[model samples]
Target: TEHEVQRWPLEPQGSTSFGLSRDGRFALLYSEEHHLVLWDLEQNKKLATLGELDADGNAVSHIRISDNGRFAVTAGQMNFAVWDLGWTQAQGLWSISDALIRDIDITSNGEQVLLGLSNGKAIYVNLVTGRRLEFLAHREKVNSVAISPNGRFALTGGNDYKAYLWDTESGQLLRTF
Candidate 1:
């Protein structure tokens, strides 16, 4: 398959990780020095660079951009935050107590953030209200998580050798396998 490649010629020189929004218009890049930057992929421009997070000072390990390009969530060893793209501020910032977040995905409509934790929990946070719904999905570490394309359901997998289907709105367990 032929694909187009995008490059950042002046991209900060360091180990960096980025998350692409579902629409492929934006990228949230985290550098080794714990710097977070928003890039406009469609226009090939740097949109915004957030100030250093003085809360924990830890490097972000993972990032996920919502489908509608409205939000970007980032997590590190001890911090997790949801950025409001419109305002360019972290709308919901948490000093996480459990283990680090292992993986993340956003609901199709970009209203919810699904998180997989190292402490065996699957959590989804509502961006609008900053409400969080959490449950013990596994006895061991949760390794992966994904939301249904319609934004109504979720699935999670973990070290416990099982997968779970959940209702996003009510945070109810629908099935376990």
Candidate 2:
């Protein structure tokens, strides 16, 4: 698939991940060296830069914007943090185990975040309460995780080569593959 392309070159501080807001109004590119640049896509220009997430030289694994574009999630090796798009610093919404986080997913309602750990366990955290929700399924290194659009269930695939379904509330195994 060949298509026309254009390029504009600018120097950004460090390694970064790009995420587009749900409404497409804003785009955020964050760097590993503790900086994030917000661009206004419609205006075709850089809007603002926030000196946030300056924790370590740890590379960011994933960046996710909430469905409404009001919240954002950033993942690093030791810790994961969530930010309000309107502000530079992240709100104290949730935190994960210091086990080299591999992946992160936010619910459409912005009520929960699912984190996949390098040690093979997947945990769900409630944004409002900052509590780790009960999760029971994976027995080995979890390779991937997904949640239903309605946020009723989660599916996980891992080194075990098995996919499992679990209830979001009770953390009970609903099915296995």
What candidate 1 gets wrong by more than 4 Å, as runs, is 1-6, 10-12, 108-111, 127-131, 148-151
Per-candidate TM equals: 0.80, 0.77
Worst 10 residues of 2 by lDDT: 6-15
Quick one: how many clashes does candidate 1 have? 0
List, residue by residue over 1-177, the lDDT tens digit for candidate 1: 977675665265764567888778788888755388888887888788874444656777788877677877777766777787767787667666777788887765556778889899988777667788887858988888887755678899999999999998887899998
Candidate 1 to native Cα RMSD, angstroms: 3.1
Q: What lDDT tens digits, residue by residue, belong to model 2 across residues 83-122?
A: 7766655675344554667777777666677777778788
Q: Evaluate all candidate structures by whole-model CA lDDT and list the values in order.
A: 0.77, 0.69
Evaluate model 2: give its lDDT: 0.69
Per-residue error (Å), model 2, residue 46:
2.6
